[model samples]
Every structure is written in C-alpha cells, then in structure tokens.
Target: MTRDDPRHDVAAVVAALVAEASDGQITAAGALAEPDSLALLGLTSLGQVRLIQAVERRFGIAVEPDDDLVALDTVESLARYLRERGVA
Candidate 1:
C-alpha cells in the first residue's frame, strides 16, 4: 500500500467505513483482507445495509440491491471495484 496507489487509499477508506458501520466490531487491524471478512463483519442485516450506504456515500457509487456483494468481500476487492468504477 503506497500513496501512489489508488487501491491503497480506497482500501483504507473502505476499511474505515466498515469499521464505523460495524460500530467497531470490524477494525482495520482485524485482518480485513481476508475473503471471509465481509461475512464476519456484516453480522446483521441492518449492518450490511449500513456498510453499503456508507461506502456508497463516500465514493458516490451505488451498490444496487441486486449487485453481488461478494465483490466487496475483502478490502482489496472493494478497492478494485471502486477503481473500476472510476473512483480514482
């Protein structure tokens, strides 16, 4: 992760948003890169919605209700997703 890498910044923001949405249940130091991190972070239905909303607002992107959330399963993937959407 470097300042020159958009993914680095995107990943950090995503992690921060997830942490906030989880009420600290999910943290940057809690191995947010694992594929199962999303499964564990979103312990509740409301949590999932909140996480999506937070990220959407921050990046001005929308995660349609029909979108496959697996793309956001990990920080890296979410960062890539954001980059693909022209976030950087």
Candidate 2:
C-alpha cells in the first residue's frame, strides 16, 4: 500500500505491541520511553520476537525471522521500517 494509506499507520501497531509487551500497563507516554525508562516493561529480546510475531499476525504480513526490526526503536522508526519493507 502507499505510504499515506490509512492502513500504514505502523505507530498504532507498534503501540499495541508495546502495550502487549507491557501487559497493558504502559500508557502512550510510557511506551514512548521504551528501551530506556520503560525497560522494566519487559521489552526484552524475547519480547521483541513476540512483538514481531504479533505484528505479522495482526497485519497478515510475513516477516523474515532475522529481519532487522531492532531499528524500530520508536513509533516513527517502526512506521518507516514497515514502509521500507513494503509491509505498510
């Protein structure tokens, strides 16, 4: 889909994943500080795998197991990453 497509709002997906990772206790402000202040929310390596799986399932997209999703550290980054991979 095109970048401007409403379906390409990767931030929403990422936010959902972050909320899931945090067990729904993380608010928008909290998730934004993930990997730093929100490190206690279980955003670990295993959590990353779970997030990827969730993203794939939610979006009906197949992401390579080794795909570089680590760079998706922020909502904006995740959106750009999805766009670059043609998933958004």
Candidate 3:
C-alpha cells in the first residue's frame, strides 16, 4: 500500500471510519466543518463504539477506556492525535 503524510491523510481515514460507523449519516465536510460538535454529526452511542474500534484498527493503537471521547470529536483532531502517535 502507498503511504502519505499522516498529517495530510489522517482526515481521510477518520472520515471513512466515521462514514462507515455512522452509515452515511454524516459527511466528511460536515464533520470537518464542525470538528468539536460530535452530537451534530449524528454520532450515537453505538456509532461511538464503532468509531473507536475503527480508530484502533486503523491506527493500530488501542484507545484506553479513560481516553476522552471529546478529543475524538473531529476528523482533523482525530488525525492529529493519531499522527502524534506515529500512526502515519
């Protein structure tokens, strides 16, 4: 597989994961536009679980239960966090 800068590409992964988890209820633009408002993105309780799993799998990093959910609210923010962890 080809690789790119995680800083630039992480948003795509996050967007895809959110779309998959949300079942198309949210779009990448909408999610990126409002990176801090997850509720507005239609992320339900079940969707949250799916998103977390997707993140873990994509980044190969396990998210601890103590991790703040609020921090993963946006594609950009999530990408930044993952990139910081050397996921790129």
In terms of lDDT, which candidate is strongest? 3
Q: Point out where model 1 deviates above 4 Å.
A: 1-8
Strongest candidate by TM-score: 3
lDDT of candidate 1 at residue 85, scale 0 to 100: 82
Model 3, span 1-88: residue lDDT tens: 4565543577877887888888889876676677476667788888889999988987889878786656677777777778777877
Sort the predicted structures by lDDT, highest score first.
Answer: 3, 1, 2
Candidate 2 Cα lDDT to native = 0.63
Runs of candidate 3 with Cα error greater than 4 angstroms are 1-8
Decoy 1 TM-score against native: 0.76
lDDT of 1 by residue, 1-88 (tens): 6787754587778877777777887786463566665766554667667878998998898987686677767777877788888986
Cα error, candidate 1, residue 68 (Å): 2.7
The backbone clash count of each candidate, in order, is: 0, 0, 0
* lDDT, candidate 3, at 55: 89
lDDT of 3 at 33: 74
Query: Which clashing pairs does model 3 show?
Result: none
